[model samples]
Target: MKATEMRSDCPISSSLDIFGDKWSLLIVRDLMLHKSRTYGDFTKSAEKIATNILANRLQLLEDNGIIIKLPYPGNKVKGLYRLSPKGVDLIPALIEIALWGGRNISNTYDGSPFLKEVKKSKTKFLKKVMDDLLEEETNIG
Candidate 1:
């Protein structure tokens, strides 16, 4: 469904309704940045999302058309989830959030490389991510 058709009353509320959950965004981040595709990969995240929560978020993301599951070529019972175009669109927002956190939040691990890339050329960073996503999707397919 189109974004226009998704909600009419309050855009923010509608968006939040779709992506308000913390796990959902983290799943998206993993898919976007780490190219994580399986349940095992998500469970291995630094945040250590619970198994049941991860399952629910994956289902929700699939239901929302933000991700699609493709079967593992050699094994029909196994499959992998990858971002759809709608999901890939969240990259800019993620970049902004990462940059903001890197700037204001104090953390031991320096995110300077990512921050510098984002600051120097947002367009380039976005393009690179888009390319990477496309490449990943192609490989999966």
Candidate 2:
């Protein structure tokens, strides 16, 4: 299903419809942090996502314009997935969620380098993330 065809009654629901699943957001997190681009990269994550589920989530992300698949420069048969502008815009939301979890939830994912960077300089970190994402998008295009 396409994002355009999703319900519009509640904005939150609309977003949830597209990215409600645990694995999908995790995939986005991996892209945002680890710069994981290939299917193998995602499948080999610590969460150990199943192969079929990973494939489905990747397709969903691509269909929703959250990511774009580009041919690996050296290998036409293999492609790398990178965040689209729409996906990059999600960084602030992800950061906020991570901050909330760190504050309120015990035993949260503890080793996030990005979260540490945000803790040091939130404004600068966010700006840098946007700049980097924009640069990547420009290069890809």
Candidate 3:
């Protein structure tokens, strides 16, 4: 989809033309929240996104400047996904959504204790996520 073909001049609609679908944003959510960096990691998500859908969404995100694929330093044949600066900008939105859900959804988050802290301190949580991305070793003990 192109800006020229958008339904209207509404900014939200225009943005949706790129990532309006649940799968696209869910991919971003995974990247933001779970440190998922590879195709398999995304496939193993609880949502269990299908292989073909994941591939198409990944390509779509890359074309939109939301993410970039890089060759894994150790595995020549495998690729790792990383967020671009533009993608990093989505962190706050994710946090806000999470916090809202945390407040409204009962017995929410899958028993992750950190979520308690996140609901208390969104800034700190967002910082940690951003920092973790910067320190992407993809290989650690």
Candidate 4:
């Protein structure tokens, strides 16, 4: 569904309106897991997202309050992106998706020992990721 069109009032539909595209969640994943900040960092993802699509997804995410664009003191030309609390809250979901893929999908990651802990305790992992995201936000903001 298009961003402007509300398919339904369902929470899932609402979320999909903003991030159901191929690239948005990957952008989030990068920020949440890899500490990506600059446009250059996103463009460098292994999936090789197109510059135009990456730009579109970044704007959409920022508009939806899933992420915030921060000023980069080191580089005036490039913007820095960080997860808001709402975005940070998606960590558990990401962990679930990763665990599902790792279990059902072929050749997926075994993840790290930390990830094993995440699988056992999603709440704990969520808190950890949230804490880290907020700390990054504090340092940057």
Using lDDT as the measure, the top candidate is 2
Question: Candidate 2's residue-wise lDDT over 1-141, tens digit each?
Answer: 545456777988888888988888888888887543788888778999999899999999999999888887788778888888888888888888888998889888667787788888878888887777777767765
Off by over 4 Å in 2: 1-8, 109-111
Error of 4 at 27 (Å): 0.7
Estimate TM-scores for all models.
0.84, 0.88, 0.83, 0.87
Task: Superpose all Cα atoms of candidate 1 onto the true structure and report the RMSD in Å to 1 decimal.
Answer: 3.4
Instruction: Give model 3's clash tally.
Output: 0
After superposition, the stretches of candidate 1 with alpha carbons farther than 4 Å from their true spots are 1-8
Model 2 TM? 0.88
Q: How many clashes does each candidate structure show, in the order listed?
A: 0, 0, 0, 0
Residue 19, candidate 3: how far off, in angstroms?
1.5
lDDT of each: 0.80, 0.82, 0.78, 0.80
Over the stretch 79-118, how does candidate 4's per-residue lDDT look in tens digits?
8888887888777777777788778988765776656877
Give the residue spans of candidate 4 off by over 4 A.
1-3, 112-114
Q: Which candidate is the best by TM-score?
A: 2
What's the candidate order when arranged by decreasing TM-score?
2, 4, 1, 3
- Which stretches in model 3 have alpha-carbon errors above 4 Å? 1-5, 137-141
Task: Report lDDT (Cα) of residue 124, candidate 2.
Answer: 85
Model 1: per-residue Cα lDDT over 6-77, one tens digit each? 555686777778888788988888888765477788898899999988888888888888888888678777
TM-score of 3: 0.83
lDDT of 3 by residue, 32-102 (tens): 77554788889888888999999999998998898878886789877778887788888787677777777
